[model samples]
Target: LDPNRLPRTIDGLINALTGELDDETLLIIDDAHLIDEQPELRALIERFIMAQPPRLHLILAGWHEPDSPLIATARLRGEALLIETADLLFTSDEAAQLWQQAGKTLPVDFDELMSFSAGWPLALRIALDATNWRSALGLREQKSKPALDDYLEREVFARLPTPLQRCLQRSAGLRWITPDLCAAIDPTFNSSELIAELRRRRLFVEPFGEHGVRFQPLIAAWLSRRAAADPEWVHLHRKAAVYFQQHGDHESALYHQIAAGDPAAVTTFLPLARTLLAERRAEAVLDWMRRLALTGDETPELIEIQAAALHQLNRLEAALATYRRAERAFAASGDRLGQSRCLRGQAAIYLDTVQPAPATDLLRRALKLLPRQCGAERIELLLMQAENWAN
Candidate 1:
């Protein structure tokens, strides 16, 4: 066991261990990332892992994924398993069990608790302690119980570098955080480095897609509250709106546009609603309608998009009524194309319900109103007319 006689090769290590024990063994290294700071020790561990010694298991735990070639290579060879933060978050059923174990009936708004906590165990514990639990779980309220704030400040935010902290504060309202979005939020910072640092720190941010990350709901809610009174918040939202719009994420763009208190938010929404309808995301279009309170609008295009969504959802009578409303509005506005589209929508419901005669009449009127250059519209109407005749 002389320190100077340590085995440097896999075979020599096995020989050293052969007479030591006869049973399976586990070797776990917590804060294993610290070992990574020592190149010689890190290389020794890597070699040991490559050896795959008999009945020996090694587990490495740390705040960040290991920056080790052996870890990746072992993973590829199915000799190693890596568990991520997302894997450890509580499921809905697990959260329910937690409530039951606490000797409390599950709250009716348990889903809100789950959403607010984002299944983070620490956040859930904090929420479970609140007397005014509804306010604690309310995202709209954006209230962080003092205990929650204190813990997060001391444990999480305080651990971040100053620049990263500023970046998070500035981009608090953004749902999906990308390097490009971060750059748009604060041009003075090297956003890519800040984002990479965030991921490495494991500071309540999770890798989202190929190029983005998202804050856990509790973190986002807390930061949003802090950013609320900043006059620059609205300006940042405007910049976010422009960024998302340029990136073709119309739904997120619309959200930011509204948050910016932009007068053109509705204009941005109309096109996004139409696009959602066209993409057959009918439920999404309806969700946006309710979210934006667009139901009371008299705009022809808004009515048309809602009607189209209802049509896709097979709410035929509702769709027909809405289409009729849109058709009248279009006619009053002298928009022949809008009127023609509404007629086509009504005819589709009629055709669906086996009312070919009414559908044929609607299609004929639509064809007359539709412009001559509308080849696809004309073809669709002619095809519907032929279907009606066949019926």
Candidate 2:
């Protein structure tokens, strides 16, 4: 029966499930996060638990550790059993058994191999395939960097629709992408349909909730490489960055902006880092600034922004280094305005570190670099120098 065609009421769901399924029926709902948003469905599940028919069992699987309302309700009524995925991977003996089952002779240090995989089934399986079990003693000696990307490119990306592939690339730009933002990026595409297609392919696109999705770390890394290769797709990244910035998702916004290669994104992200600094979120600010540096195309203005962020985070040495880099880059580009700015930033760093002589030298250099006709910045630099000396 089509659930959508049924009456949109709790009675309809209870009637449908209880009437259609046998008392002995066991239903497994994987990815409960996706279904929880449907209050009617949650209510139906709740009602089933409350009714408590003999031999009826419901199993829910999700990444989140917290219990949902449905899970809590079922547990309260003594009707649900919770099993964590971590418990299912393997014990050392079990891992050895798996290796033995694959017709591999174990090395003396075989336990190390199992520990390295952390009992992840996929990693174990991949290791088994990559190593020659018949000559297992030499397996440890044959340290191979697995071509994980090649495997996914063939197995995963090859199977997705072009639009879904584009969506995945855009998602790589974001730390997280919700369905609404995904819809915004490709207005003509249906998020529901695309998500279903991705799930069917087992592409690591896990539901964040009913309204959002996230990529597994390995998959996110792979998609980022592919996205970097295609400059045309950068616009989708920019769109995601702007959306996240508007919603106050600063880290996510910074990620997408860096991926999109938008200069304006630097402006949007700098203030957030400053706010984080103000709140004593110093470590977080440093992390974001490091990410900004990795983008590898810093303008003098961007470098100054990064230096200021670093200085606020109390990373005085890194701030000085960034200022020096900005100074060199500006001089190479012959951007005198940028050079003057870099000099002033370097002077500030020197002042903060109590290196008054160097600070005075930098200020004098900055005054010279500033166009004689442009007196405003020169005056500001002199005032800053005077204040530094006073301190």
Q: Which model scores highest in TM-score? A: 1
Candidate 1 — number of clashing residue pairs? 0
10 residues in a row with least lDDT, candidate 2? 133-142
lDDT per model vs. reference? 0.79, 0.67
User: How do the residues 1-391 of candidate 1 rate in per-residue lDDT, one tens digit apiece?
Assistant: 5534544454586656655757888878787765545676676677777765577788888866667887877889997888888898899999888989999777787897887677888767767777656465445454445556677778667755578678877877788788788788777868777778778767788788887888777777677666666778899999999998898988988888777778788888888877787789999988877767677345999999988998999998889999999999999999999999999999989888889889988999999998899999899999999888888
Candidate 2 lDDT by residue in tens digits, 1-391? 5676544454555567766776587667676544434665565556655664455566666543232565676577875665655676777788788879989776565666565555657656666775443223122223442366667777666654578677676555555566678776767667777776566444555677776666665556556666666776688887777777787787777777877767765676667766775786766765776666644245565566567677776788888898788888889889888888878878887787778888888898888888888888878998988988887
Model 2, runs deviating above 4 Å: 1-76, 86-174, 187-210, 222-299, 302-325, 328-337, 364-383
Task: Report how far residue 80 has shifted in candidate 2, in Å.
Answer: 2.7
Best by lDDT: 1
* Model 1 lDDT, full chain set: 0.79
Clashes of 2: 0
- Would you give me the overall lDDT of model 2? 0.67
